[model samples]
Target: MSKPTPLSGFPEWLPAQRMIEQNVVERIRATFELYGYAPLETRAVEPLDQLLRKGETSKEVYVLRRLQEDPGARTDDSLGLHFDLTVPFARFVLENSGKLQFPFRRYQIQKVWRGERPQEGRYREFLQADIDVVDRDNLPFHYDTEMPLVIGDAFASLPIPKATILVNNRKVCEGFYRGLGLEDPDQVLRTVDKLDKIGPEKVAALLVETAGATDAQAAACLKLAAISTGDASFVDQVRALGVTNDLLDEGLEELVRVVDAGTEYAPGLIRAELKIARGLDYYTGTVYETQLQGYERFGSICSGGRYENLATSGNERFPGVGISIGVSRMLGLLFGHNALTISRSVPTGVVVALPAEELRPACDRIAQALRRRGISTEVAPAAAKFGKQIRFAERRGIPFVWFPGADGEPDTIKDIRSGDQVEADAATWAPPAEDLIPVVSKA
Candidate 1:
C-alpha cells in the first residue's frame, strides 16, 4: 500500500499538545460560563440549502457525501458540514425560538469545515470557540462592545504575551465607500481586505484599475487605510476627510461607540482602525481581528464581525454579533515558541507504583482515593522495577509518586521536580495547591 497523504490545513497534535488544546478550550468555556452565558450544542449537519442560505458563504462551504454508494444511488440528499457556529446557531434559534429566552446569551464550541485552499495558519477542519448574544429584534449595542473584551480576557489569561485586538465597523467602511462614490462597496471591501497581503501601493493600483476608482479616490482610500492610532485623533482625521455624507458620519459614530466602550472597561485594549476590512459579506455592523504583539506577520489568529439579519429558518430572526478563536493557529504559535504554554499534559497530581502483582489493588485504591479528593492520579500499569516505574511517573509529569510502603508508611509521595520524597497517608496527603492544579502561561 502507498503511504498516506498529509492533509493540508488540518493539524493534528501529539498527546501532550492535545492536553494544551484542552486547557485552552476549557479556559474559554469557563470564562463564558462565569459571565452567565448558557451553553448550547447544535447538530453537526444541516440541510444544504439551510447551510448555504447565504449565497456568498455557500462558495467556501464543503458539502458532505459518502463515496461508498453508486453515483446513481438514491440520495440521502446533499448535506454539508457546518461552516461556522454562527450560521448553525441562527438556524437553531429560528427552529426553536419558542424554547429560547430573549437576549439569549450562549456559547458554542464545535468543529466547522470550510473548503478553501488550506494554507499556513488556515485550516480545512478546526475547532471554533464562539460566544454570541441573539436578541429578540435588535442585538444590544452593549453586547457588541462587551464581546471583544470578554474574548480579549480569555487571550490575556492564556500563556501568550499581550494581544492587541483591532476593531472596525462594516457600516463605517460601507458608509465611507458609498460617500466616495463606489456603488459596489462590497468589491471595494474585498480589495481593502488584501491590503495586508499585497501592500497599500499595490492595493491602490488594483482599486483604480479594477474598482473604477480615480487616482484621487484611490489615494484617499489608501490614506484612510493607513490610519491607526491609540487616541481619538482618528475620529478627527476621518472628519477632516471632508466628504460630507450622512451615512459616512454615521459609520464614524458607530466606530466611536465601539472603541469608547472597549476602552472604558479595559483602558487601551481596543485599537480603532479604519483599514480593517473583514472578508465576510454578512457582517453589517462591527468587524474585528486579533494579532499577537510579535506575531503580526503570522496574520490574524482570530476574527469576526456583526451581522444584521443572519438567522432565517423560514421563521423569525436570530440577529447576532460574535467572534471566533482559531484554536489551531493560536496553538501553532502557542505550543512551540515562547509565546504561550501550559504545564505539561498528563497533568498527573499523583502516580501510584505497583510493587508486586498482588500490590496492584492497593495502588488502584490509592489512585481512586486521590481522585475522589480532586487530585488526578495514575497507577503504574504493571509491577515493574522501581527505577522504571519512577521514570514512567516522571515522563508523565506526575508531581507526586506514591510508593506503597505496607509496613511503616502506607503512602509516600515524591515531588519529581524537587526530588523531595516524604511519607504520608493516602487519605490526608495533599500536594501544593498550585501543583494540584496545572500551571498555565500568562501575561
Candidate 2:
C-alpha cells in the first residue's frame, strides 16, 4: 500500500506543542473560573435538523451513522458533529432550564468539526474555547460590553501576537439592508459575510444579482459595509451613509456602549465596526470577530455574537450573548510563525546518571526523592559513558544532570542551558524555581 496520507489543515503537535496548547487551555479555564463561570461539556453531535435550524448553508456539517447491524433499523436522531459549542450550549440550557440557575455563566472548551475547505488557520476539526452568560429571560445589556472584555483578557494574557476584536451589531446590519430595500435581510447578511472571501465589489454584485438590490441600493450597502473606525464617532460616519431605522440605531448605540465600557475597564479592547456583519442568523445584538496583529491573512481566530433564545420550544425565551476563541486555529498561526514557543522538550527536572553498576540504586533513590518532592526526575536507562549520559540529558533538554561525585559520593546538579555546575545534596536539593517548572515550547 502507499504511504499514509497526511490530511491538510489537520496539524498535530508533538509533546512540546501539545503542552503549549494545554497551557493555553489551562489559562483560559483559570481566567473563566476567576470570574465565577462554571465549566461545562456538551455532546459533540446534535440532530441535523437542530444543527440546520438557523439556515447556515456554508456550515459543512459532518454527519454520522452507526455501523449497520440490521437493514430495517431507523433513527430520528440523525446526528452531525456540531460546528461550534454555542449552539449546543443553547440547547443544553433550554433542555435543563429547571435544574440550572438563571443568568447561567458557562465555559466550554472542546473539539468542533466543520468541513469547509482548509485554509491557513482553518481546518475540518479544531478546538474552540467559549464563555457565555445566558439569562432565562431577556439578557442584560451590560453583558454585551462585559463579554468582550472577558475574552480580550484571555487573549491579552497569552504570549501570542496582540489581537484586535472588531465589534458590530446585527440589528444595525439588518436595518441598513432593510433601508436599502433589500427584500431579504438574511440573504444580505450572507452576502456581506463573504466580503472577506470576495471583495466589496463582488459582494455588491451578489446582492444586486441574487438578493434583488438595485445598483444604488447595493452601493449604499457596500458603503455601509466599508464603515470601520477606532471610536464611537464611527457611528457618526455610519449614519452618514443615510440609512434610518430604530433597530439599526439600537444596534449602533449598543456597540458604542461596548466601546465606551471596554475603554473604561480595559482601554482599547473593543472597537466598533460597521462592516463586521456576523453572518450567523441567530446573532441579534453585538457581534465580535478577533484578528491577530501581523497575522491578518490568518483570518479571525475568534468570533461570536448575541442570540435570541438558543433553545426555543416556541414560547420560552433564553436570550444570551457570547464569544468563542478558535484555540486550534490560533495555535496553528502562533506556532507556524514562531509567535509562541517553548524552551524544552521533556519535563525532566533532573536525570541521575549511574556512576557504576554498583551505584545505580543510589541514583534511583535520589531521583525518587525528587519525585516525592513533587519534582520531575528520571534515572539513566543503563550504565553508559558520562559523555553519553550528559548527551541524553542535553538531547531531551533535561537541565540537571546528576553524577556520582566521587567513589559513591552525593552528586552535582548541572544547568544544561547555562552550563553552570553546582555541588549540592541530592537528598534535599532544590532547583531554581523556574528550573523546577520546565519551560514549554511549540514543536
Candidate 3:
C-alpha cells in the first residue's frame, strides 16, 4: 500500500515533544489544584442549540452524525462537537446544580474541536486548559481579578515565554459606546476586535458601515481601545476620553480592582488593554486576552472572560468568569520554532540489563524493586552483550543500566553517560532527582 498522507489540522507530536507537552500540562494542573480548583471532564458533544447560543460560532461547530443513518430517523437535528469548554460547562452546571456547591471552581483539560481552517497556532482539534468560577445568583467581582492571577501563576510555572494578560470589560465598552450615542455596542465590539487582524483604519470603516457610527464616533471608539496601562491609570485615561455613564463608571471601578490585584499579586503579568474586546456577547463584565511574548502575531494563546448570564435555571442565574490556555496551539508554535527542549524522549530512568535469556525474571524483579520506590524502570528488551545493553540505554536517553548480582555478589549500576559503574542494591538505589523524570525547558 502507498504511504498515507498527513492530515493538516490534527497534530501528533514526537516522543520528545510529547514529553515536553505532558510536563507543561502537569505544571498547569498543579498550579490549578494549588488554587483549590477541582478537576473536571465533560462530554465532547453538546446540543446544537446550546453550541449556537454564542454569537458567530455556528460556522466553527462540527456537527455529529452516524454514517449510513437515515437523515429523517430523528425528529430533531441537534448535536455538534463543542467548540469550546465554557458552553458545555454551563450546561454541566445547570444539569447538576443540585449536587454542586456555590462558586464552583473547576479546571478542565480536554480536547476541543472546531470546523475551521487550521493555521499557525490554530487547529481543528486541540487541547484546552480552562479554569472557571461560577456561582448561583451574582458571582463576586473578585473572580474577574482572580482569573488572570491564576493564569499568570500557571504560565509563570512553565518554561514558555512570558504571557501578558490583556484585559477589558464589556461594561466599559458598551457604556462608552452608549455614551457616544451608538446603539449597537456589540457591533462596535465585534468590529474593534478585528483591530489586530485588520488595521485601525479598516476597523473604523467597518464600525461606520456595520455599527452605524459616524467617522468621529468610530475614531472615539479607537481612542478608547488604544488606552492600555499597567496599573489603575487606565481609569483616568478612559475618564480623559470624556465619556461618562453609571455603567462606565462601574466597569472602570471593577477593572481597576482587577488591574490593582494583578499589580499587587503578579506584577507586570496583567495589563489593562482596552482594545481587547472579546467578541463573545456573553461577556458582560471583564474580558481577557493573553499574548505570548515574541509570538504576539500568533494571536491570543489564552483567553476568556466574565459572563453574567451564560448558565441559568428557572428563576436562577449562574454567573461566571474563566480563562483557557490553548495547550496544543502553544506547544505547536513552540515546537515549530524549536523553542522547547526535554531531557529525554521517554520516561524510563533505568534499564535493567539482561545478561541472558534465563535471567529475564531476575531482571524483571530488579525493575519492580526500583519502581516500588517511585523510580521509572524497565527491563532490557534482549539478552544482548553488556556493552550493547549500555548502548541501548544511551540511545533512548536512559541514564543508568543495572546489572543483577553475579553469583552472590551485590548488583551494580552504571551511568552510561559518565561511564561510572558502582555496586548498588536495587532495593535501596535511586537515580538523582533531576534524572528521575524528563525535564522540560526552553531551548
lDDT of each structure?
A: 0.80, 0.83, 0.91
lDDT of 1: 0.80
Q: In candidate 2, what are the lDDT values of residues 1-443, reduced to their tens digit?
A: 98999998677888888878988998888888888889999999998888988757445898888787455666566789998898899899989998999899999999999888997778889999999899977888998888878888888778777788889888888887887777798888888889988898899899888899999988888888888776788788878887788878888888889888887877777777777877667888788999988988767889998898566776888999889999999998877777776666777878888868887787788888889888898889888898898899888878888876886655787887888887888668888888786564323
> What does candidate 3 score on TM?
0.97
Tell me the TM-score of each prediction against the true structure. Answer: 0.93, 0.95, 0.97
Better of 1 and 3 by TM-score: 3
Residues 22-95 of candidate 1: C-alpha lDDT, one tens digit per residue: 88889889888887789889888887877766636777778778878678975556888898888888888887
Model 3 segments more than 4 A misplaced: 75-77
Instruction: List CA RMSD, all candidates.
Output: 2.4, 2.0, 1.3
Considering only N, C-alpha and C atoms within 3 Å, which residue pairs clash in candidate 2? 341-441, 342-440, 342-441, 342-442
Top TM-score: which candidate number? 3
Candidate 2 structure, TM-score to reference: 0.95
Highest lDDT: give the candidate number: 3
Ranking by lDDT: 3, 2, 1
Compare candidates 2 and 3 on lDDT and give the better one.
3
